[model samples]
Target: MKKVFQLILIIFSILNSAQQSEIFKLKNYRISVLNDSIQETSGLNFFSEKLYTFNDSGNPAELYEIDKKTGKILKILKVKAENKDWEALTNDGENFYIGDFGNNAGIRQDLKIFKIPFKNNQLQNDSLKIISFYYPEQQDFTPKNISTDFDLESMIYLNGKLHIFTKEWASKSTTHYTLDPDNFEKQAAQKIETFKTGFMISDAYYFEKKLFVVGYTKKTEVFLMIFNESNSGIFFKNNPWKLYLGSALSIGQIEGIAVDETGIYISGEKFYSPIGNTKPYFYFIPKEKLKF
Candidate 1:
C-alpha cells in the first residue's frame, strides 16, 4: 500500500509540472528603466489617449504623464485628494477615479475613491468628489497584516461602473466587486464573482473587450492573465490565458498594466529583498507578440 501511494504521488507531481510547463513565457519586451520620481508606480491608466501613472502610499498625491516608448515623465498633475493608500487608477473619458483603498491589514473602515473631472486638457481639482464604500460581508475589523484577503489594488471603469478586484493574499484568489461612481454616500460594494488566480492581483486594465490583470506571487513569480469579457459583461467566467512573465527578482515587482490597440504596457516598481534589489522597469509588448 505504501508503494502504491508513492506511485500516485509521483504521477500527480508529473501532471502538475506538465500543466505549469504549458504557460507561455513573456520575453524581449523590456523598454526602459523607470525614473526615480515614480519609483513606486502602483497603477497605470490611459486618459484621452495619453498614458499616466502614480505612486502608491507614502508619496505625493500627483499623477505623472509618461512617454510610452521611453519611461520618462512628461508632465505632473497635482491632485487635491489625500493619498492614503491609493493603489488603483481608472477613467471614464470625462473623469478619472483614484482608488485609495489599499487595506493590507484589513482593518480600514475609510475606503474611498476620488473622482476628478478632466475637461479641455485641465484637471478640475476644485470639483473633486469622494466616493466611500465597504465590503458588506466583512464583519470583522481585525488586523491580519499581509495575510488578509480584503486588500484591494486593482480597478477598472467599465460601462458606467467601477469594477474592483481584491488582492486575496491568503486564498491566492481575487473577488470582483462593482460600485456606482455616481454615489457619494458610503455604500456597500456589490459582490459579483470570484476567481482563483493563484496569485495576488496588483493592477488591471481593460481594452477591446479584454481584461488584463497582472501581479506577483509570494515566491516572486510574476504573471499576467488575459480574460475575455463575456457577452453579459461578466469576466472570470472563462478560463484566462495565464502567461509567466518572469521572476520579480529579475523584472521587479509588477504592479501596473495598461493595454491599447497598439500594444500592452507594463510597469514594475523597485523591489528589495534580503537577497538583492531590482530597479523599476517599463515594458512594451506588441499586440502581435501575444497569443490571445
Candidate 2:
C-alpha cells in the first residue's frame, strides 16, 4: 500500500509540472510608461497605422494617439459623446466604436457604444451614433460590485456586428454576444457562445483568423489565450491555447490588446492592491517571440 501511494504522488507531480511548463514567461518584453493624462488607459486599437487609446470612467470624452515607441501622447481627439466607463475600442475600417459598458457592478442599464466616423484621419464631430443594448438574460437590477457576470469590458467589430465578451467575475467565464451596429434601438444582444476561461476576459483582438484575449486572474497572474477561428466570426466554438504570460504585478492589470503585422501591443492601467502597486505601462511583444 505504501509503494502504491508513493507512485501515485509521483505521477501527480509530473502532471503538475507539465501544466506549469506550458506557461511561458514574458521575459523579452518592453515596458513604456504612459503619460499622466492616460494613467487610467483602458482600451487600445490600431487604425490607419496609428495606435489609439482612451481612459475609462471619470476621464474626459477623448481619444489619445500615443507614440508606440515612447508612449508619448501625440494627439488628442475630443469625442462629442460622454465617456461613461469607456472600456474597449475597435474599428471597422471606416468608423471607430467605443464601448461605454464598463459595468463593474451589474446595475447599469445605460450600456452604450459610441460610433464615430472619421475622414482624413480626423473625427467628424457632426455625425455621431449611439448604440444602446442590454442582456436579456440578466433580470436583476441590483448592484453587486464584484459578484456579477453582467459586467463587460471587451468588444470587437466583426462582420458588420459588434461582438462583446463579458467580464464575468462570478463564473470566471466569458460569454460571446452579438449586437447590431447600425440599429439605434435598444436591442437585446444575442448570446452566441460561452467559454470557461478560468479568468476574466478584459480585451479581445482578432487577427489573421485567430482571436486573442488578454486578462488576469484575481491572484494577479496575467494570461493570454489564442483561439483559431473555425468559421466567419465564430471563434468561441474552438478550444483556445492558453498561456500564462506573466503576473499583473509586472504587467500592471492588462486591459487592452491590439495586433498588427509587426507584433502584439498591450496596455495596462495603474493597478493597486494589497500586494503592491503596478505602474501604468505599455508592453510590446514581437511576432517572432509568440511563435512558441
lDDT of 1: 0.89
TM-score of 2: 0.91
Which lDDT tens digits does candidate 1 get at residues 1-292? 7756754564464345336734545447889999999999998999988999999999999999999999899999999988999999999999999999999999999999999998886789999999999999899889999889999999999988999999999999999999999999999999999999988999999888988999977767788889999865589889988877777777889999999888999999999865668989999998888845
Off by over 4 Å in 1: 1-27
Candidate 2 residue runs with Cα over 4 Å from true position: 1-21
* TM per candidate: 0.92, 0.91
lDDT of 2 by residue, 1-292 (tens): 7756754564465345337536766635856877899999898999998999999999999999988787789999999988889999999999999999999889999999999998887997789899999999999979899779999999988899999999999899999999999999999999998998978988999888888898876656678899898989889886788887766766688888888888888888999865558889888888888862
Top lDDT model: 1
